[model samples]
Target: MAEKYRVGIIGRTDRGNYGHGLDSVWREIDRAQVIAVADDDERGRWSARSRTGAERAYSDYREMLEQEQLDIVAVAPRWMNEHKDMMLAAAEHGCHIYTEKPFCRDLTEADEIVAACEMRHLKLAIAHQTRWTPTLDVVKREISKGLIGRVLEIRGRGKEDARRGGGEDLWVLGSHVLDLMRVFGGDPQTCYATVLENGEPVTGSHVREGNEGIGPLAGDAINAMYTLPEGATGYFGSHRGTAGDPSRFGIQVFGSEGVVEFLTGHLAPCHVLRDSSWSPGRSRKEWVPISSNGVGKPETLPRTGLHGGNVLAVNDLIDCIGNPEQQPKCSMYDARWTVEMIAGVFESHRTGGPVTLPLKQRENPLTLL
Candidate 1:
């Protein structure tokens, strides 16, 4: 019989709680065993164990790691504060990691965490499961088939809802947007952005600490642009209380022949507009839906709600763990570039010019403001 992967979970109820169902999703994986769970809060630990059917629970994650010989761990807390430390601990214990989004506070944190995982030969998967969703593969295949013609530009936006806008919006919602831009446009070569608050450019006074230990942040509105390695240009924008339409909070790929607009969510639908003019009334063609399996109506998809993405991500981790040469869809290296994209926006604003890729500023760019 094949070995069942021993898995542990780490969470903090006070800080985003079990990270969008990371604890429970492992239960769905046939080859995974929920061996133990840890959370700094006593209630969180108990709740996680109860939900996951974990064999043991602890209030301190380090203690759990030291005691359990885990093959994998879900660093489930959404809080950035504990992310770096927890991943480091798991790497030292020689366990693979599956963690939440917006991987860490800054490029510096991403660098260290990735290094630790690499040195230990551990596979680290971030919870950016949009990358794993098969529907996206369909979208990419369509793009390559000239459905959108020669891709020329990419546009993206954050949730920009009332709950969190500006800097918080960028770190939280923008991570997904920026990563998607990379998917369509390739690695960014340079970035130019303007950070704003109350319709004015953000200044040093506007920079402040972020929620859930996201680290220093600035601006309530952001307008950024990037040059993709493929020569396509990418744009990202967000503002407070600007949650226009849920469908609008996604990426659009423009090509010389047509355009593709993608909605963000689990198995989110993508549409193709064949009219090169882009303007609706002026365009000669209409928007049509693309599916994971076919070209028309979306297929009946799995129920991949909040926890669903985690399950898909975990499955990929398990597969990659067994095949050392294969990389998970949302690998640690991909997460680092996402962080760099976020930081580059700020660095561009600070420098009053475009900031080149692989940002020179390793720390949180907002801190420098």
Candidate 2:
């Protein structure tokens, strides 16, 4: 019998909680066991302990880390402010980490986390579940086979609800889109963006504390463009109250020969239009559905939903732990690049021009405004 990896979970209850079922998902992984849980809130701690079937619960995550001999730590908070500390603590304890997204508050925090993990040779995976979806592999294969010849552009957008539109949407939901952008379009070379608040450009006075501890934020509408590899361009935009009927919140990869569109999820809907004209009206082509197996094939993965995605991510982390050469589909470096992309939007807006990649400013750009 193989050794079962002992996992410790960290949550903050009403404050970000066990992000997208990060705690309970461990129950589905037979190779791992949830040994303990930590949450500052008393009720949340006990409730988490029950939910995860953890053997113990602690009020302080630091205390939990010190006492428990954990093989893995789930930094389950959706909130970004606590991510840096929680991740650092996990690394210090020599435990691998699987955490929620929007990696951290800024590039500086992201850099620190990456350095720590790299120093300890710890494998860290972020929950950019879309990257782990089998459909993504099919999409990539199709793109490579010239189904979408010479990918010219990739466009993505957020949910753009009235509340979390623009900057907030960019940070929260945009992270997923940005990650996919890199997957297809390659590393961004430069970003130029415009941020607006009430039909006008955002200024320092407009900046305020964002929800879920995202630090200073401004703008209710954002239009950003990135220069991707091989002359491919990427665009991400969101506006307050502008979401569509079915929610126009996904990525569309446009190529010289055709286009591929996909939503965000482990089993996200994907379609391919094999038309060189790039228009259904001109070519009279049909959009073909894609599944986990291939275009027009049925999904083969036994599990689905966010829970299923967590299982895939956790399994990848375990695999990477056993094989040091492999990295998770949503590796820590990939998560940090998403942060840099989000920061570039603000940095570009602040400078009123294009900002280069690997942003020189590591702090929140809104603060500098």
By TM-score, who's the top model here? 2
Instruction: Mark the 10 consecutive residues where model 1 has the least summed lDDT.
Output: 301-310
Stretches of candidate 2 off by over 4 Å are 300-303
lDDT of 2 by residue, 1-369 (tens): 239999999999889999997998899898999999999999999999999999999999999999999999999999989999999999999999999988999999999999999999999999988888888888898889888889998999999999999999999999999999999988999999999999999999999999999999999999999999899999999998899889878899999989999889889788999898889997889999999889878777675788888888999889899988888889999999999999999999999999999898889899999
Runs off by more than 4 Å, candidate 1:
none
CA lDDT of each candidate?
Answer: 0.86, 0.92
Estimate, for each residue in 212-254, the C-alpha lDDT of model 1 and write its tens digit: 7888888889899999876789999988888876447889999
Q: Model 1 compared with the native: what TM-score?
A: 0.97
Q: Which RMSD does model 2 reach against the true structure?
A: 1.3
Model 2 CA lDDT for position 125 = 95
Residue pair clashes in candidate 1: 166-220
lDDT of 1 at 161: 82
